[model samples]
Target: MIQVEGLTKRYGERTAINKLTFHADKGEIVGFLGPNGAGKTTTMRILTGYMPPSEGKASVAGFDLLTQSLEVRKRVGYLPENVPLYPEMSVVQYLDFMAELRQVPNRNERVDEVMEVVHIADRAESFVSNLSKGLRQRVGLAQALLHKPEVLILDEPMEGLDPQQQIEVKRLLREVGAAQTVMLSTHILAHAQELCDRVIIINGGQIVAEDTPDRLSAQIAGGRRLQLEVDGDGDGLLAELRALPGLSSVRVVADGRFEIETAPGPDVRPLIASTVVGGGWKLLELRRERLSLEEIFIQLTREEAEAAAAAETGAPLAEGQAPGSDSAAG
Candidate 1:
């Protein structure tokens, strides 16, 4: 478990992170998502005791970050964006060194366990310099898990690997996250959408949004379309549905299928079902379409940037107004 409150970091007059606050519950996999220069790495460093925050408070595994840095570090396993590894050391040798440095009991056994977890036991004898980028990443992960920390803090764990390797790492993270808390920062939206139970989106040194992937998607998209399959001609049904209150638009997809768009509100399936059954049409299936995480991320970040710009220029944003243009917000 982890908690942060009012976490701020500054270098000279430039602020990297400003008043960041969030929490990762025990056994929860929370994704830390942001674009370049969004203070993700800065926040991770403060959490890992790699650097102290300029102001704020934090706790890791129930230990105070400021007063108990060592205890917090002991419970956290960190894999940085650019892994710091000894190129000349063999996989087994490097893990052994890390285990010893952490003062882990039964160092050999722990090393073997982590090597197996990351599927790098076969490369135990290979030098770090000789392994492929993916294998090297595995080695980095193994070291992080060597101590059996309660919390895993990963920065870009899937950054440079091939597709297959990325899949493999995601599987490993899922397996580990089943028992330990995981806080990972990644640029890959699809990966986050697949692996994270909750996502925190940050921009301009502040948190712009935080919620489950599904909720965030629905919130940004505002409304969704419904797909229906019936056992009769859909032309009559389409016209009738379009005439329903709160129904925005209706289109026939095929001889027996239709797509219905609705205004943002409660589910309209009950009304649609009653109308179909009452009219002697068989309602086979009805499903609502949801937006993808990519679409949600783009819309949320762009809105945040536009709001900031509006504030700076003292421009009044109209009620219910959407963002003006598609700019690279990140």
Candidate 2:
């Protein structure tokens, strides 16, 4: 488990993290997502006790990050975006050394276990310098797991890998996630959407959104849409559909098709079908139109920028935080 309160980090005059607050429960895979220069790496470093925040406090596995830095370091496994390695050391030797560095008891068993976990046991005897990029990444992961830390702080863990290697690393992360709290920071929205139970999207050194993928998408897009095609004058039929409760806006598109928004937490397809039949219109097609994660990400980023500008001008953000939603800006 991890907790951060009013976490703020600054370098010179620029603030990298501004009053950021969030928490991840045990056995949960929480994705940390943001655009470039969003302070994701900064936050990870502070949590790992590699750096100190300029303000606020944090804890990992019930240990204070500031006062109990040593305990926090012992409980967190950190895999930096660019994993530091001793290229001269063989795979087995590197892991063995890391195990010892962590003061892991039974270092031999721990080294062997992690090597197998990351599937680099075959190259145990091979020097790290000779391994491919994918293999090297695996080695980095193996070293991180060598001590069996309670929490994993991985920054861009899937970066620079081919599709096959990405899949392999993703599978390994999922397995590890089942037993430890995982805080993965990456720019890949699709990967986060697939692997995370909840996503924290930060922008301009602050949290702009945080929720499950489904909830986040619905919140931004104002709920999902249902596209329908019926054999009739779609114009009047669109109006009739809009008149129904739980149905919001309706647009009649080309080819007798209509795009409609439905109320949250309700299935309006059956009602639409019945309405079409009553209107003497034959149904042709009907299905939900879900937005891609990329679209959602773009929309959220733009919104955050606009909100930040509004704040600078002393204007209230038209869409500050939705009810029951956490939204912040620089």
Candidate 3:
């Protein structure tokens, strides 16, 4: 329900978001995963018609984001990073006001329905000023969904909440994604992996990687990691493991735990096991693990940053090398 093409937003000479082109389909939950200042909020604002892009065009729910801005706003539910709330107003009052603004049918009942939908009904009588950050987020979400828009765009929806609150919000988001287009921006890769049906990783104001979590994980893993939990201190083993042939790198994660990376090819478990056994160390745990979503995110962003730097340095990346890699292995 969202289509963006070459969307560019510039602040004077600095580009906030550059040439971003992606879409979120109906009944899909797409996440924009990036670090701070990676242009996620800028892109969201442009899409929601809160701001204009310096270049390119976008549409939301079949309405042009530029020309048909009002219609786009009508179909989009936006929960910005800092939700604008009236501290003096109660939850119900604030939602009632928003409902009136949207001319919602059955405004009162719809307000209550959305409050329940976001699990903020118990605080209906409480003033918005009295609510916690999580509660405030719920209120903002309630107002956004007060009119049941076609698309939901949330920026950093789970920033300050405790684990329990995060779970509650995640559940609510999953339920909402069942019918509407849900697009959220977050720096948390784990959250994106758990929540998004499709993830688009952004960095340096550009698209880094976009794919399903599983596919991205498998593709960008580059090399597989083997986790080892030694019975005793693995500090000294770090050097020996790093010197091992066919291994990318080895580091002691904890006093007794070590993580080893190996290029994707032959299975090296037997050789690693023998080496550890020969060292007279008790191997408590040894298993090959796929790269986590967080690792993939870091790799993609790092590569993008490196590539951007290389471009500025008048040097192009090598063949088969990652976007910004200085070498094939880089």
Looking at candidate 3, what is the lDDT of residue 155? 93
Off by over 4 Å in 2: 231-275, 312-330
How do the residues 201-294 of candidate 3 rate in per-residue lDDT, one tens digit apiece?
8887888788898767756553467788878786578777777788988877889898788776665667778888889888888865656789
TM-score head-to-head 2 vs 3, winner: 2
Candidate 2's residue-wise lDDT over 204-245, tens digit each?
Answer: 888877889877765555434777887766657867887888
Candidate order, TM-score descending: 2, 3, 1
The global C-alpha lDDT for each of the candidates, from Candidate 1 onward, is 0.84, 0.84, 0.84
Angstrom error of the Cα, residue 296, model 1: value is: 2.6
On a 0 to 1 TM-score scale, where does candidate 1 land against the true structure?
0.82
Residue 52, candidate 3: alpha-carbon lDDT? 94
Cα-based TM-score, every candidate: 0.82, 0.84, 0.82
Each model's number of backbone clashes?
Answer: 0, 0, 1
The true-versus-predicted C-alpha distance at residue 193 of model 1, in Å, is 3.3
**Alpha-carbon error at 255 in model 3, in Å?**
12
Error of 1 at 272 (Å): 3.9
Candidate number with greatest TM-score:
2
Worst 10 residues of 1 by lDDT: 321-330
